[model samples]
Target chain A: MLLQILNIVGIVAFAASGALVGVRKQLDVFGICVVGATTGIGGGILRDLLLGVHPPDSLSKWPNITASVATSLVVFFAHPVLDRIWSAVVLFDALGMGLFAAGGATVALQHGSGALGGVLIGATAAIGGGVIRDMLVNEVPLLLQRDLYALPALLGALLVVVCESIDLPQGISLIAGTAAATGLRCLALWQRWQLPRARVKD
Target chain B: MLLQILNIVGIVAFAASGALVGVRKQLDVFGICVVGATTGIGGGILRDLLLGVHPPDSLSKWPNITASVATSLVVFFAHPVLDRIWSAVVLFDALGMGLFAAGGATVALQHGSGALGGVLIGATAAIGGGVIRDMLVNEVPLLLQRDLYALPALLGALLVVVCESIDLPQGISLIAGTAAATGLRCLALWQRWQLPRARVKD
Candidate 1:
């Protein structure tokens, strides 16, 4: 029951973020809904596909799609004040990312992926939807470039694997993993943390 | 035997197109190779995943990876003048798109996807790679916006389904599908064909 709630919340968070981006980009309602739906479920779908899950539960199940589309439409019609909601959206996005990273690792481990593969798959699940969302609007996946985004996801996933390896309770380990990722992301957002890049001298 | 050859050619062509985009974006060699490899195999992987092919042959097989990476490297090192070979690249890309569309639909039908499903999967196979490539470089997928790209792919896929329904020989039908898609795409390139879009009055 709790897991289902988490998934629903994650869908809403992700969908809201996607819808906001679509509005910012001036896409029509249909385009916004498409982006929102893809962003909400793209990661889980990719994770399931990688883990050999046929047809992907997220795709097969209607609730997830309905939630994503409905949230997007609500956001679109709200005529949101971008400055007011942008930070809140980021917060929800961070929460979604953290939850997804931990959740995805658990799924991968259940499917017999190794520790290393679990971490990779987890990060993919956390970030894949955002990547798709950005691609639709022709922007660089800001998830990859700016902020300490993927690192937190990896750390969270790793924590989950570590907990599993150490025989910790799944519930406790999941909470720890999500907390670590979410905290780190929130801190990064607060502090404007970014990884350095290699620049060739002109 | 013929199908394998077609897949290999498609991989090479798609990889070349991806590498060229990387060069245009001025990405580093590693980035270019990543883009190229993804472009070569992404479409097929997506099609298979959606059609319930577990682990997707493109992901499990090394030859696909090797071909894509090697082609990318060759293209990067060759450093050909763009104006000289761009038209040629367009021709090869169109051929790749056509072959993959037909090939993907055939695979879908064999796996028991109905006609409509087969057509959608076929177009996904044709365009998914380029979408990934463009996403990597942060460009609007020129494939979608301009030119008769997707329409030809859908038509090609449809042709394959039509032939199957009519009991045409597989080889003849595949050939017909490929020719139709490729010829249409090339003609569009020559004529600059594009679908009309909704423009909001300023």
Candidate 2:
């Protein structure tokens, strides 16, 4: 039940991020919806394909598709108003990342994926959508660019794996992972944190 | 041996198409190469993933990737000359769609995929790269918009299925399917064929 709620929340949040990008790029309504739906569900779809699962849950489940489509429609209509609360959108996105990362790891674990596979799946499930979204929008992916995006998701996945190894309660582990990821992302943003790099001539 | 040669030709052709789009979009050299590579190989990647094949052939085989990357770079350096011959790109792309659509259908049939599944895979293998390229460029997918793109591939797939049912020689059938698809696309272009649509009232 808890996982389901988190899933819906995560899908909606990711959809918003996608919609925001589409709007920034001046896409028409249909294009905005395509981007939103793709970002919202792309991760799970990729994960499932990798796991040799066909017609992934996102495709089979009416709710997930409906949620993404609904979120897309909402963003289409309310983007102007929502632009006023940009910070809130960022917050929700962070939360969604946390939830989905944990959920992906949990799903992989339940399917008997090994510890390493679980962690990788979790990370992919969290960051894949955003990478694809950025790629589609012809921008350097945010995760690869700044603010410790993938780092938090990787850490969160690891935490979940550790909690599972120790037989910790699922709900508690999920909450802990989510909090850690979201907090880390927020901290990175607040501090303007970025990956270390040396200057290279182009 | 002939099929392999055709495959390489098709790869180079698609790579050129990708490079053309990238140049028009004003992407940097690196971005252009990425788009070219993606446009050249993204569809097959999707097909492999759906088939539960790991380390997709395009990624695993150095020759294939090398061919695509080298072609992309060549296109980058010779953009002006290439642009002058750009009409050939569309013709080559049409031929590539034919070759890949038949190739995909053959593989799916070998794997015992149903008729519909084989047709879907065949069409996807043909246009999937274009779709990915369009998505990355933030444009409406050409497959969903202009040209009778999907229809040609579908017809090719059906032709392959019918040939197999009638015990036609595999080599002959494959060639026939490819020719049919390519010819159909060229005819469609010549005739300005389009899917029916209702006028939008807005």
Give the interface RMSD values of the models in order. Answer: 6.3, 7.9
Residue B199, model 1, lDDT: 97
Can you give the lDDT of residue A17 in candidate 1?
Answer: 84
Question: Which candidate achieves the best TM-score against the true structure?
Answer: 2
lDDT of 2 by residue, A1-202 (tens): 8877877888888888887776666665656766787788877777786577753677546778678878877877776665344465467568778877888887788888889988999889988888877777677887766768888998887788889989999997788887788789989999997777899999
Model 1 misplaced stretches (Cα beyond 4 Å): A1-42, A49-123, A126-130, A136-138, A142-202, B81-89, B193-202
Distance (Å) between predicted and true CA of B103, model 1? Answer: 0.5
TM-score of 2: 0.63
Tell me how many clashing residue pairs each candidate has. Answer: 0, 0
In model 2, the Cα lDDT at residue A83 comes to 38
lDDT of 2 at B95: 78
Tens-digit lDDT track of model 1 for A1-202: 5556676777888888888888878899999999988889888888898889877889899888989999899989984655666666677678878888888888888887777667767777887887888887777775644557777888998899899999998887778888888899899889986543322221
Task: State in Å the error of residue A180, model 1.
Answer: 16
